[model samples]
Target: QFVLPDANLGVIAFIRLAGIKADQLLKNCPKEYWVPGLTYMSEWSHQWLDYVTRTSGRLTKSVRFCDLGDFKMSMLEREVTRRDGEAMGVMEDCYPQLLQTVFLCNASSWIQVPWRLLRPIMPKRVTSKFEIISPETNVHERKMLLQYIDEENLPTRFGGKNAVWPVHFPLPEN
Candidate 1:
């Protein structure tokens, strides 16, 4: 459910595939498929920037790269550190300025290992950006998401009153 919750607050939800072989997730996504999607993001971000200019609105933009299937760290690392890693370089290089907040969801602490590995390799500008996912927050996750998004727009897994999840992709093969 990638949405600009309000015109004033351009919030988007981009769900990354988790708990899968890294190659299938990004490394092996065909160039034809990969290139266009990257192009779309570049275009869409420019649109968002233009909207900001016209509206004179200040917003906190966020990207949620969810670990929906509870991916393990080993799988997570390949997507970020591997040289042929598709989205990794693009995200770190291209997407930084457009976003103010980023978070990872449903992933475990194994994130630390890969994060540490990638941290040294990334430039200061990239390294400064942080993705926070806190399950231990005082408020529940469902309530937290609902605070910004109306219940009707949220995925059911987030305790949304409307809309089932898997809105984009179908069930993964075991």
Candidate 2:
């Protein structure tokens, strides 16, 4: 995932996620490294928060675009889910209310199973912010996402003109 260079409406950050084989990539790591891995993610989250605060303002928040275009069932293994839960917990602990919305794009019907199980467990504050977009409603959801994020800030893959990932730019100052 990477943040867009420009903030949405000058205050909201646009974070884009590219679908990747995350489970395969991390499943081989030993359990001993998990803590350090979460720490690294925390540090990265701080950098992003700092960037938004500096570029926009202290009140700036984020909107995440989770593109599951290449997602597979194997990616939802127990280990991956556990790691993800830990990382999310850390983020919430470190920066509450930093996320304004989460757009789950290109989601298949398989997602409903997990969403059903997860939704009841998640706080209303968190669950209410999520917006899932399936293949059937891609066009409509794209319009919805555009309502919050300007077309210029969105990446080409998400119906915007920005083709480059923000990683190619500079990292936020520590």
Candidate 3:
């Protein structure tokens, strides 16, 4: 079976079942910057139906924008496609497996540098207790900072088990 991200996988499965040859070409495709790590989330949910449809040659699906009091989906959508004219797709079931494989094959040295270097840059005030800050808030800035460090620090490889960098954070005193 072909393992793919949820949005693409679902579309491919549907197309194949309908007797169509579908190729999900993502080469040089635009990245969805607004929704960070969305490809790591589940793909079979209804919320991502429009994204799946748009990317899989099915653009007729209705697209609605919702506001969550503080943020609007339209704004996020615009930001996603702002860089490369591409939007984010929903996550698939195989994403975790893909990450596991990626983690195993990449070089440990490449993974360790970012984690080690970023420790000093992370806000010292960001304790574990106040972790629910919005992406629009200062807390969100820290989250992005950490995510950027991790992504840049992770190693990319084809085939081999590699050790991941250790994340060291001081525990809160009781």
* Winning model by TM-score: 2
Model 3 ranges off by over 4 Å: 1-25, 28-41, 45-106, 123-174
The TM-score of candidate 2 is 0.67
lDDT by residue (tens digit), candidate 2, 1-174: 444354423223333333445655576676667756766755665556666677666555566677766666765667766876877787778778777777777766788678978999999987888877752246666787776566665666666656765423344343
Off by over 4 Å in 2: 7-19, 54-58, 112-123, 134-140, 147-149, 163-174
Clash count for candidate 3 is 1
Backbone clash pairs for candidate 3 read 6-92
- How many steric clashes between backbone atoms does each model show? 0, 0, 1
lDDT, model 2: 0.62
**CA lDDT of 13 in candidate 1?**
57
What lDDT, from 0 to 1, does candidate 3 have?
0.27
| Model 1 per-residue lDDT tens digits across residues 1-174 | 454544454445556555346665456766567655655655565466557546764544454435344565455454334433554466547655665544455545567567768888888776655643443332465455554556675555444554554544322221
Please write out the lDDT profile of model 3 over residues 36-129, one tens digit for every residue: 4333332333334445545677532211111122222223333324432222323223332111111111113433455457646777542221
RMSD of each: 7.0, 4.4, 19.3
